[model samples]
Target: MRRLIFWTTVVSGIAAAYLLYKKGVPPGTIASEVIANPVGTLIHEL
Candidate 1:
């Protein structure tokens, strides 16, 4: 259960970074935002 959340967050972060990068969002900015709020970013993306 715990590991699930961890992996989910990891995949979510990677997906977010990919999408943002495709959209021309700066990598540095995406790194901070995704690192700062993985769950929130995932939920918001949903």
Candidate 2:
């Protein structure tokens, strides 16, 4: 349902923000890194 999709998006966005915070990177920087290699970005995040 639409409500479920909206909630999922919101939760995922929050999770991503937390991950970026922990990694000491901004969301915008992560987004740009993702453009090069998503896997590398994830590894760097971890």
Candidate 3:
């Protein structure tokens, strides 16, 4: 169960990043934004 949860979260995060990229967000911006403020980035994205 723990393993399943971990994979699911990993896949979901990847999908989220891909979607952001498809929307024209730069990869560097995404990485920097996530590193600087993860919670804020998630909130802004959602």
Candidate 4:
């Protein structure tokens, strides 16, 4: 259960970054968001 949510959040974050990349969002912004997103999600989950 927890494992599943963790993986899902990770995959979703990556997918979001990919979409942002495809939409021409800058790499620096995407990189920060990608790194921050999972930490935010896990923090919220707890």
Considering every candidate listed, which one attains the maximal lDDT?
1
**lDDT tens digits, residue span 1-46, model 1:** 9999899999888877777777798888889989998767667666
Task: Evaluate all candidate structures by whole-model CA lDDT and list the values in order.
Answer: 0.82, 0.62, 0.67, 0.72
Q: lDDT, candidate 1, residue 10?
A: 93
lDDT of 3 by residue, 1-46 (tens): 9998767656556655765677899999777765665555555677
> What are the clashing pairs of model 4?
none
Deviation of model 2 at 9, angstroms: 0.0
Off by over 4 Å in 1: none
Candidate 3 regions with alpha-carbon error over 4 angstroms: 32-46
How far out, in Å, is residue 14 in model 1? 0.4
Q: Ranking under TM-score, best-scoring first?
A: 1, 4, 3, 2
lDDT of 2 at 26: 76
With candidate 3 superimposed using the best TM-score fit, by how many Å does residue 28's alpha carbon deviate from the native? 2.6
Worst 10 residues of 4 by lDDT: 37-46
Using lDDT as the measure, name the better of candidate 1 and candidate 3. 1
lDDT of 4 by residue, 1-46 (tens): 9999888888877777777788798999878877878545334333
Question: For residues 1-46, what per-residue lDDT tens digits would candidate 2 score against the true structure?
Answer: 9998767655555555567768788768766655555444445556
Best by TM-score: 1
lDDT of 4: 0.72
